[model samples]
Target: MLRLIAATLCLRCQRVRALPANLRSCATLSSAENRHTVEALYNLSVDIQKIRKLKGWVLHQSPVYVREVADLLKDMGASGAIVARILALHPEAILCSPDQVRAQRELWMSVCRNQTELVGIIEKFPASFFTSSSHHVNQRDNIAYFQSLHLNKRIITKLMASAPQSFSRPVGQNEVMVCTLQQAYLELGGEEANMRIWLQKLLSQNPFVLLKPPEVLRQNLLFLRDKGFTTAELLRLLSKLRGFVTELNPDSMRHTLAYAQDTMGCSEAELRGIVLECPALLYYSETILAERFQGLLGSGIRMAQIIETPTVLELTTQIVNYRIQRLRAHGYDIRTGSLKPLSGTKKDFEMSYGKLQLRRERPLFNPVAPLKADD
Candidate 1:
């Protein structure tokens, strides 16, 4: 009788065999969630263990270190994208410090000897790794802080030993401190004070030439030599030297020549003649000429009128005739005649002089008081 009842019950359960799709999906999701949770915990433990092995830290996993690592990650301020990239690259070290963090930071500051190496290390770490906002300060301030920390003092000393060729313009007090540090590094070897004194005396005399290149100095000296600058004048100019000596700006050549004249107490014409001999100086006068012409035109003076004035006309005509004769001597066809008109538009008429009819279009004077053939 019990077997009969069980068989009947089994037949009824077979008739209701199909479960609803939604209920089946729910069951599958629950199983997947449990699997992922267990896998994630296992991976976390493995990563922590790996970090401990690699860094050779014997310290037991402490809540404080874990919290510190969490805080560091939070302060890193990296977006989710960057965090994902970092994790993918170092999955095993993702949750723990790679080494004794404080010791590593100190080593970074000390072992790397030069600014280039220091900068490289700093660049590798995320900005938040430094912990202090002051670490991100400017180069000068950063150097100072490094020195105060007594970290990497030997490398800093080595870097300071090389003589710096350029100092920042408008140098501040901090920069001056950096300069003093460099000077102190040099003084460690003895006779550094003598070098400073020599530089100071040299700068005191030729302040203008201090920043100028050696080539520029040579060029200027050659120019002065050609201009017959006296020994005293040269000495005076050299003695007043200051920062960043450089060649005079090409555009300022004329003004500089004028200055040279004044400095030497020479006449303007004499100075100008000397300037013309230096091809480099031609750009200055040419620029001045262009400016002057622009000003004249801007003032409403016509160029044609200026050149066609009675005095200028005579001078120009004489020069033109002289040039034409020279060209003729060289077997070139040359023509010279009075300015004349031709039949056309005004411009065409103006341009056709000598090539067409010779009727005076704009006479400067009535036929030079016609001479009598009887005379």
Candidate 2:
């Protein structure tokens, strides 16, 4: 019955918007008696479990209203918990006419394809249903335009998962943005006709890149290009992790670069090398980078070696400190391996240098901050 209401009345109710001053002719509009029944059910005392069932309709459920709204959601696969959560976050959503909610739910289900997917997104963004069906239609058009790009399903899913709000843009605006990006990628060169496909995939993997205005993406590439990254290097960075360009703060990148050259004694060429190896280093706090370099030097690792093995920069201060202290306690020299172990995984570290068997006799590791040794 609820499904029937969702399928038949959703768009029809949306078309009406509101009952006219003379609703006498409209057959589907809930009568005053229906409102009274809803109020009666709402006031009826019930167990906590049943309360969950009534949650979405408690505040505003005429017989017709409950049938169309809450039951529609339940029919679409929203659990009692999900229904409760949506109501608690936006109880006034129940005040919306049943038709609007049916239309909205139908729209969500069309793209999301399942109750779980719909619920997961709602959990993350509880206000998703706040907008009217008109807003939803616009967003739906944006998604349809993306599909029209001939992108693979993997790319589409990834993009939507990363930045669901992209669906909220006006359909016309989204069409323009997609066209702008498509042209940019085509001119990006390489793979000829496949360049646009590559660009779509790149944006999907690095959804944060799409959150920025299209101009920002262009400006970032230009910034890196002017900073001596060749076309190949810029492409590598954009493809691997576009956020390196988009999330980068120019001041932060510069300060880290200066620290690398002046304080750490890395030459210009070496700094560039380090960035290519680990572009994320530019975003690290100056203080931590300095401390890590100091620790390495204090342990007899050469500055030139550190520059050559720039991958070691990915090591956190806590992991390095913990490893170094453990090595010294067990009479092992920290510099014996030239910090090669720094690039190894946690399992490798624990099995080879960590001596986990011995650690068992000691206090437990703190899961909250595993970097800290036992007090």
Candidate 3:
């Protein structure tokens, strides 16, 4: 009977051992189901976030936070039913408040004890899990948060370097105008073309230059009109131009002086002297100067008076000759005179003639009578 009792005890112990094994198998299955369910939910969240991005919603938080939460749920080893129940109890509670996240981290540490692998997993969870702070709402704050992840500093630097400097000061309106004018001036050709371009550019840049637009036009008309440019054309051109001084080229001044001399029927030498003495007048060339000279002369204006008082006689002679030539070329009757004179009687000539006549009369009277008497 004692032997029978011993066999029975052994059988009971064996059954108890089998019960523990069955419980362990059930727990393992539950843990695997919970992991699968959590993974699915996390995947769904990711899909939603992606959709939000496609819809142009700003993702202010780091993606790693979501992933870390999913990983933690996977490591929990809870049953799918239990996980579903937990999620249902507080639908969005997986994302803990900052304070709650910190508490959870502390609890995880206590539960994990000195397990290195568990500690590693806890460390991998996002810092956001420990704080409810919405610092990520700001892009700069978000960048700082990412840097805290021990990412490569070089990568951050490179990203910053690649970004455009949008904060730099914008070009001023005045500066823009100046730049535009400069470009136009460069594009135009010839002296007149250049002047037009320059004037336009200057005016466009600074409207103040044309404070008296009509007056400016009148002045330009008067000046250019005198240089043989048609008054109407001068008016049209000045109306179109903007800046006066900025468009003035030193070389253009020379050409203008030449034109003025030509129009005024003045010699090149005289024009050059005038330009040297009064540089302001050298705005037209010989052609224009000549035309102007004929106009003035036709109006019965005297050349001597028009040429400044300081001009030498030689310069006046040149001016006269140039005027005569131009007038003749244009089919106008022009009379010219030389500096020298033709043969004419003078007081000295008469005195010399009288002396010669007295000498000849005395010789004829005295010599002729003696010769006849001697014969």
Give the best candidate by TM-score. Answer: 2
- In candidate 2, the residue pairs with backbone N, CA or C atoms under 3 Å apart (3 or more residues apart, or in different chains) clash, namely none
**How well is each residue in 239-325 modelled by candidate 1, as lDDT tens digits?**
333222234443355455664455335576555444433223323344444453354334343544323221212122334344334
> For model 1, what is the error of residue 174's alpha carbon versus the real structure, in angstroms, after optimal superposition?
22
Better of 1 and 3 by TM-score: 1
The CA lDDT of each predicted structure is: 0.38, 0.61, 0.40
Instruction: Give the lDDT ranking, best first.
Output: 2, 3, 1
Top lDDT prediction, candidate number? 2
TM-score of each: 0.21, 0.64, 0.18
User: Per-residue alpha-carbon lDDT of model 3 for 1-375, expressed as tens digits?
Assistant: 999999999999887676543233332322223343333444433332232334212122222233444444445543344333333333343455444544455433432434343334433432322334342223233235325533344333222222212101122322343344444334332254455444444444433442322333344434544545443433334334434433444456656765565555788667545544443344345554556556545645456645653222222334545544544443444333221110012343345445545554565355545455554
lDDT by residue for model 2 over 190-288, one digit each (tens)? 455766666676676566555566666576666666678766666666655644356775667777878777865766766777778877777778897
The TM-score that candidate 3 achieves is: 0.18
- The predicted structure with the larger lDDT, 1 or 3, is 3
Residue ranges of candidate 2 with Cα displaced over 4 Å:
1-70, 89-97, 153-158, 172-189, 192-197, 249-251, 285-288, 291-302, 322-334, 338-340, 344-375
Could you tell me the lDDT of residue 248 within candidate 1?
A: 49
Candidate 3 wrong stretches, greater than 4 Å: 1-243, 261-288, 309-375
Score residue 72 of candidate 1 by CA lDDT. 39
Report, for all candidates in order, the number of backbone clashes.
19, 0, 27
Backbone clashes, candidate 3:
27
